[model samples]
Target: MTNKKQRLASVDALRGFDMFWIIGGEALFAPLLALTGWSLFAFGHEQMQHSQWHGFRFYDLIFPLFIFLSGVTLGIANKSLQGLPLENRWPVYRKAIKRLLILIGLGIVYNHGWGSGIPADLSEIRYASVLARIGFAWFFAAMIVWHFGPRAQYAIAAAILLGYWLLQVGFGPLTPADSVNSWLDQCCLPGITYLNRPYDPEGLLSTLPSIVNALVGVFAGRWLRQKAGQHTNILVGLAAGGLACLLVGLLWHRVYPINKELWTGSFVLITSACSLLLLALFYLLVDRWQWRYFNYFFAVIGCNAILVYLGTSLVNWQYSSNSLFGGIAAALPDAAGTLVIACGVLLLQWLVLRWLYRREIFISP
Candidate 1:
């Protein structure tokens, strides 16, 4: 395959890897602790869950990672459209807006995508969601790059990070109930939030900084697309960039605090750094080394990422798999056997995507 295609595949593989965690691949280990009665496995299982309010964990990285990937993909897409006349690029913006609407609808559906159906009250709205955040963040980043180009994209990202930090500083200290972020959010929208909490982690105000994560991703995509031919420099630069961002995040945490709920400037730096390094790792394997087969599974899921995400949400995949694979798991003598159920569900998810992959069916945007 061509180098450009390889770069794109790497992005898909990285995305598939991220989706794997969301679609229950991470849950495979949760049952291990009960099966083996081991504290270590128990600790491992706990990591699958999100950190309550402060700090970070593997699960916390999923949304931001995907956000970063969306930005990167947008960057790649933008570059590909460079030769088109300005008038011809209207479709790009049109498609973006349409996708944003679709994603917003999907996010609402995902939250209320239950058997009970949508609630009647507008108060029932869950304004903050994974899909909505991705939509808004990606939309803004793309528009910035489209209108102002890369130079301004970088400037805007930096301004967001700095401005958000300054906002927190100006707000000063805040208790959870009276937290500035949450309070401002509630004041804007009376009854819309995530998990009915005073402050939604995916709230409006916090999404400002999350845009930086995607914009940074635009730069990463640019590097990979523009400099993939220079393998050594890009790889080394990526590593150095990741480390530098991490260092900055750690140091800045002293002031702003690296809170995922807040999507704090520090949190954006730390998560974006991790996303870049992780992408580098995947790109190294799939692009640099040409280890194509290794990423086949990830590529499969990534290709149909949105479709599979919806499948996991809409269907009772876990229940169905337990009916079939629960026996296999039960037959096992060890506690790890319980994981067979989750593995079964994950397998089912992959099979669905695999079928789509075979037919070149990609439900993106």
Candidate 2:
């Protein structure tokens, strides 16, 4: 099915909700703990924090969800590339590679300050990053879409996940010092890693499985397209699929272990399942029921998702925001000051995006 050239506001809304947590919602919840003094709100704060090593949390879902959304876009846009010949598709592949390189550059810069002209110390650069992970997942997923039809995409996803699982298991008896994933990083990307750790969470080896996560998203998107206008069917299918993934993932955790750092097959399934369910929800509320007003702010951020993400780094709005609003917030009690700062910064970010949205100045890579 050809997606309308017009944007899907539901997609935008779901993306914006995901971005909200990273941009400010994560910060917002902590202060609520101080203000509300251990109510249901406290639970939100806890979920915002990542799990120590293994298991999952709401925060852990965010990264995989981003990859999943990429797949959704792929499925939604499949019509555009559906009939093109392999030779005709070279330009599109070039653009994708270009975007991937740019994302990698941005990830590196995000880790090392631009003012210092990138640290001479090689260790300062973190090549394995969220942006880099997204790039890898998106690149392969797009290639899959480019070469194969919907059926092949599913087969490819299964292969990727199963292959990665075998790799981890076949490598045998991994200790923390000898983690296969960690070893791949040390061997491949010599100078850079995250937090000076031996193994990066977004490490090279684990990235193979991450692509499967994106493929799952692609599958979900294709399903949505096939079932368009059948609201009840879509929601029921998403729920059933999500529950199956969650149950299988939990069962597989017995042998494989659902480690986000590893990007285990189980993690991919479970997280992708959650993302599918979440997408169904936003679709039902905003697109199906037409309850769009409530998530209007979310759509604003969603329009220029990457713009706001990079803007936060490129422009130090946080420092300026703190100078403007921190004093008042500081007068408040524990963690409230930080929350106020976060709110102020988020508002500033939103207004800037809102202005850009008004002018239709979306920054697309």
Candidate 3:
């Protein structure tokens, strides 16, 4: 392979597109629909929010897609590191491990930063979370791509997906009801399950399928790196991958069901498919046509995705809005106050990212 690196605009644009949902779905879009009395749009927004359990939704795609994009980026990163000395690889490995630790720490702190309401004796600080999973999955996937060739990496991904399915079906703990399908939801996962609190959103067993999401993106990255006729190949590969995933996911749903909480195989397949489709669309628009204006907004957030996520978690935007921007929003309606606050949060993060970009500072993990 040539040493030359290709910067894919679509990847950054897709990352920004995914971050848009994470930043603020309700504040950005819901209020407008409420004013128009458009019930369908309102309903769509509601559906975009996560389902309780046992079904897929537009909102559920956000995290998986983010992880998938991370995998794509990892492939690019590995490609850039080609022919480096053994000594250099150690620093990269250390950085990956550090990122994993940071993500896990953040997840724990985010959950219990104020101290859990539950007693310390009974409190089981959840070790798994979306960020934590992403960190682990990205680190491992990157390692595989870096150490092994792309073809072997693809084989490993297949093994994970297929093996996870069989493991869940065969060795998974049986539920009280003795149904094969119920194993994943009731028995396979580790955590305190009761009438009120149930399975951990980020659990141990589900991480298996979650790894596949990242690996699929690794494949996409490999395809993008191919020399001959890159645009047509990427577009075709993305379309086929997305459609195949949608179909396989629907079929798997018959048995496994698309549960985000469990991170079921079907959910992985479907979400990965959606991610591929979205990536293709972004690539076509941004890379092919050079549609660069709208991208800057998302690129700001994309550049500092983890910072924005942590900011939202730590800082109470509601309080900020009430204190800082309250006077201006007061002149407007009730929904207008919420909208202004939403925009303010976005602007706040954007300015911070812009400053960081100017300073040549970037935070990963």
Candidate 4:
């Protein structure tokens, strides 16, 4: 059966919320811990930082959550194309491929490739990047959604997580130098700049399990797209699903351990649970109950998430922020000055996104 494109403000708002942290929210808010010296801010600032080697953190959730949200969007978008002839779906498939390629290219650019000057050796480039991982995971997950039924998609996600777990267990210990994930990266992506020497967090093998993150999002997206008037039931189901995943993930952690760097199976389930619960909360507030006053700021950014992400990389926002607010910042104390500048940087980025959102220019990939 065909379905119309259901515009879920919560989805966009959530996307923007996730992007907010990446772009400037972390910078803007992290200073609060220093300024106010509040325990809450201290706790939040701690969560903002990534876990060094193993363990999960709120910051670690950012990347996988974005991928899952992309899956949710895919599920929402494909609604219109659901019953179309196979031939008719080619255009979307092409678009997905194009997006994947563009993101990969952009990922390289984000890594500061050849921009300064092409390295004498290609090995100098960081082949695996946060954006590249997102692109790859989203692309494969999209292909699965395009070609398979929900049952098959679920099975595929299960097989991927389980298979990856087996590979990690059977091949080597979960150490940076000795883990199978690192070994695969060393063998296959030779010369790639490893984020952690000899083992990039966005390495090839770990990406296999990452696809399940997006698939979980697809499941949520499909569930959300169901017929209207069942919002409460949907909320309960989402909460229950999230809690169940959390439980399973904790149990698995005993064996595999929740390692964000390795993107362990337990890590996937834990993050998926967090993503689902977050989605449920947002849907409940913004879509179901219509508490949208606070969401507009984020929704504006959400409307143009990809644009802002690339813009932050390409545009010298910091220079602009300092230029506009430097005098004010200069007048304040050190901590306060830093906060002002951060706020300015965030404001500047948001204005750019707001302008695009107002002009109805939403750039997605």
Q: How close is every model to the real structure, measured as TM-score?
A: 0.92, 0.91, 0.85, 0.93
Per-residue lDDT for 106-225 in model 3, tens only? 876655532345544333445556688888888788777877876787798888888877876676542323333344435554333322244456666666778889998887776676
Task: Write down the lDDT of every candidate, Cα atoms only.
Answer: 0.82, 0.79, 0.73, 0.84
Of 2 and 3, the candidate ahead on TM-score is: 2
Q: After superposition, how far is residue 43 of candidate 1 from its true place, in Å?
A: 5.0
Q: Pick the candidate with the highest TM-score.
A: 4
Instruction: Give each model's clash number.
Output: 1, 0, 0, 0
Check candidate 3 and list the clashing pairs.
none
What residue runs in model 2 are displaced by over 4 Å at the alpha carbon? 1-7, 79-86, 113-124, 334-338
Candidate 1 similarity to native, TM-score: 0.92
Candidate 1 at residue 332, lDDT?
Answer: 86
Tell me the tens digit of each residue's lDDT in model 1 across 263-323.
8888899998899899889978988888867789899988887877777778998898889
Clashing pairs in 2: none
Off-target runs (Cα >4 Å) in candidate 3 are: 1-8, 79-89, 113-123, 171-196, 227-229
Better of 2 and 4 by TM-score: 4
Per-model C-alpha RMSD: 2.5, 2.6, 4.1, 2.6
Model 1 CA lDDT for position 264? 84
Report the candidate with higher lDDT, 3 versus 4: 4
